[model samples]
Target: MSWTSFYLIVAGLLAFTMLLVCWPWLRRRNSMVQDSLTNVQIVKQRLEELEREASEGVISEHDRRQASDELKLALVDETSLQKEGSRTGVLPLSVGAIAALLVGIIVYFNVNQLDKVARVQHAIDALPRLSEQLAAGKSEQFNTEDVRDLALAIRQRLRGSPEDARGWMFLGRLWMSLGQDVQAIEAIERALAIDPQSTATRISYAQALMVTGEAAKFQRAQEVLQGLLSENPENDNLALMMAVVSAQLGDADTTRQYYEQIKNKLPENNDMLTQLAGRLAELENQIQDVPQGSELDTTATPGFTIEVSIAEELKSKLPEQGFLIVFAQDANSDNRMPAAVVKMPLQNFPVKVTLTTDNAMLPSYSLAQLEQARLVARISTDADVAPSPGDLEGELNAKVVAGQTSSHTIIISKERK
Candidate 1:
C-alpha cells in the first residue's frame, strides 16, 4: 500500500479511538449542567412560595425575610459547587486526551519502525526499474551509490523474508558483477541452501567458485558441474562450462568428451571450441615421445603410464583402420596446452602407453614442471587430430610429482555422436 493511504487510515483510527474514549466524559458534563439548571429553578419556586405566605400574614415579615436570605445563600453555594465540578471534570478530560495523543504518537513511531518500513517500500518499488535497466544493458546508467542503496534495500527486505531464494540469487549475482567475490559466494550459497534443486542457483554457485581461481574452489566447481551434467546431459551451455573447468583442472579426456558433446550443437568454427582443439592437439603431441617396453626409472621423470581398454559392449564397433591418441596437459596453467602427447595406429586390446617430460610438446614447459596433469585416451576412426563421430574416449586426472609416477586406467566406453 502507498504510504499516503496507510497514513490516512492510521489517522482515522486514532481519531475514532479518541472520540470513543471522550464520549462518556462529555455526556457526564452535559448531565451536570442540566442538574445545575434544575436546582436554580427549584430555588426560585421556593422563594416565590415564601413571598406569597408572608403577604397572606401566615408569618412575621422579619421571619419571612430571614428564610428568603437563607434560601438565597443555599442557592449560591449550590451554583458555585456545580460550576467548580464542571471545571474539574473538563480539565482532567482535556489533560487525558492530550496525554493519550502524545503517547500514541511516540509508540507509533518507535514500535512501528515507520522509517524502516518506508525505506523497504521505496526499495521494493525501485527494484524493477533498476533491474530492467540492467537487463537492457544500461547498467552504465546506474552509479555505484545506486547499487549500494539497492543492495542495502534487499538486505533489509531479506531480514524480514529470509526464505526468498530468488532474492538471494539476485543479490549474489549483483555482488559478483561488482567483483565482490566473497560476498557473491556467500549470497549464492544461501540461495543454494534455500533451494537446492534450482539449476540457475547451482550454475551461479559454480561460476562464483570458478571465478576465485583457487584449486580447491575449482575442484568444487568441477563437482557442481558434474552433478548438473548428470541431471541435464543435453544442456550445451552446461557442457561447455564443464569442458572449460575440466581443461582448467587438466582432465584432458573429460574436457574432450564435454567439448565434443557441445561441438555439434554450436556454430561452426566457434572460437572457444577452436581454442580447446588447439590445447588438445598440443597435449596429443606431448605424449608421442614416451618410450615403450623398457624398464625406466619412474622417479627420474614424473608422468602417467596409462592402460587403455575398450568396453565389452562396444568392441564390435571398433574400426579396423583407426588410430589411438593419448595425451597429458598441465592442470594448473591457464594456457591449458598439452605438456605431452602420443599417437599410434590402433593396436590390440589393453593398450599401454606412458607419458613423461621426454614426450614434452615444448621443452620450456614440460610434464616435469607440472604438479598435476590430466590424461586422455581416444581411438579415432581417422588420423585427423580433431575428433569425429564414432571416436571412443576416456580420461583421468593424476598428480605429477617429480619423484613419483602415477598409473591409471581409461575405459573407452563413450562414443562421439
Candidate 2:
C-alpha cells in the first residue's frame, strides 16, 4: 500500500482504538452518578413508609425516629464508599491511559512500520521524476545519499509490488547506468518475466547480458537482438546493438551488415549519422588490419585515469568481494552527478583505472567536455555507484580539457559515516 493510504488507515485504527479504550471509563462515570441518585430516592421512600406507619399507630414514634436515624447513617456510609471508590480508581485509570498511548506510539513506529513504509512510498512517488533526471544526465545534481536512498526504496517497493513491470525495467536501466551488470541483469530479467513481449525490456536485458563479459552471455544477447531485428528489420537500436555484439563475437561480416542497415536508415548530415559514419570507418580500418581468422582489438582511449589506494589502517575494514567506483564530475557544478564513471571489483590498494567518454551516464554530458573536474574513487560493499555508509572513499581535483589526457591519484583515507 502507498504511504499515504497506510497512514490514513493507521489513523482510523488509532481513533477507533482510543474510543474503545476510554469507553469503559466514560460509561462507569455516568453509571456511578445514576446509582447514587437512585439510592437517595430509595432512602426517601423508606423514610415515608416509616412516617406513615408511626401516624397510623403501627409503630411508636421513638421506633420511627430511631429507624430514621439508622437510615441516615446508611446513606452517609454509602455516599462515603462511592466517593472512596472514585478516588481509588484515579491512579489505575491514569496508568492504563498512559500505557495505551505508549503502546500506540510504539506500534505506530514498529508494527505499522511507518518510517520505512513512508520512505519507500515517497521514493516510489518520486521515481518518475528521478528517472527523467537520470535520462537527462543530471546526476551531478544528486548526492550519493540520495542515490542510495532511491536504490533502497526501489528494492523495498519491488518486494511488495513484483508485478510492476515498468518499475522493474526502470530499475534495470538504472543499474545498467551505474555499471552494476549483475544487478541490471537480475532486474531486467524480472521485467522480462512479467512482460515477455516488451521490446524495451528485451533490449535492456540483452544489453545487460552483453556487459557480463562472458562469451556465453554475449552470445545470448546476440541471439536476442537477432530475433528482435527479424521482427523489426529497420530498428536502429536493435541494429546498433547487434553490430556491437557481432564485433565482439568476431563476426566482421555480420557487424558490417548491421552497421550498413543503420547507416541506410539515417538522414545525411545529422550529427548522430556522422558519428555513426565515423564509427563505421573505424570498424572498416580494424577489419582490414586483422587477418581472416583473427579478431580486432576494440579498445579505445578512455577520457581520463584515476589511481586509487586505501590507507593501511583501513585495509582491514575492506571486504573480500565488493565494488570500486571511479567517477569524475565537473568541478564548478553544484550537482553531484558524475560526468563519467567506471565500476570495477574491489581490489588491493593502489589500483589504476580509466574513465572514458563511453562511461558517460548521459549521452549529452561526457568527461571529454569538461574543463575542470573532481574525481572520486570509492570502495563499496554493495556495488553502489554512490558512496554510502560504511564505504571508503577519496577525491582528487584535476584540470580537464576535451580530448586531453588527464590522470590523478587519490587515497581512500576515510570511511563514509
Candidate 1 lDDT, 1-417, residue by residue in tens = 677898799889988998898899889878878888898898889889998999999988998899989988998898898788878888888899999899988887778877877666777778888878878999888876568657867877788899999889988887776666677889999989999999999999999877754445767999999999999998889999888777656567887899889888877888888777776665555456444567545657787789999899888988888899888865665564567778899999899898878776555456875777878788876554344556788877788877666788988888876
Identify the candidate with maximal TM-score.
2
Kindly list the per-residue Cα lDDT of model 2 for residues 1-417, writing each as its tens digit.
555776699789978987897788879878999999999999999999999999999999999999999999999999999889888887798898889889878876677655765677677777787768879999778765567556766887788898999889878877776666777888998998899999888988998887754445767899999889889997888887887776545455787798787876767876655644554554466556443544523342336777788989999999888999888876764335467888888766689888877887654356644667888888887655644457888997887754556677899999877
| Candidate 1 segments whose C-alpha is farther than 4 A from its true place | 148-172, 175-202, 208-223, 230-417
Candidate 1: RMSD over Cα atoms?
A: 19.9
Candidate 2: misplaced stretches above 4 Å? 1-11, 26-31, 110-171, 180-183, 190-200, 229-417
All candidates: TM-score: 0.48, 0.51
Best by lDDT: 1
Clashes per model (N, Cα, C within 3 A): 9, 6
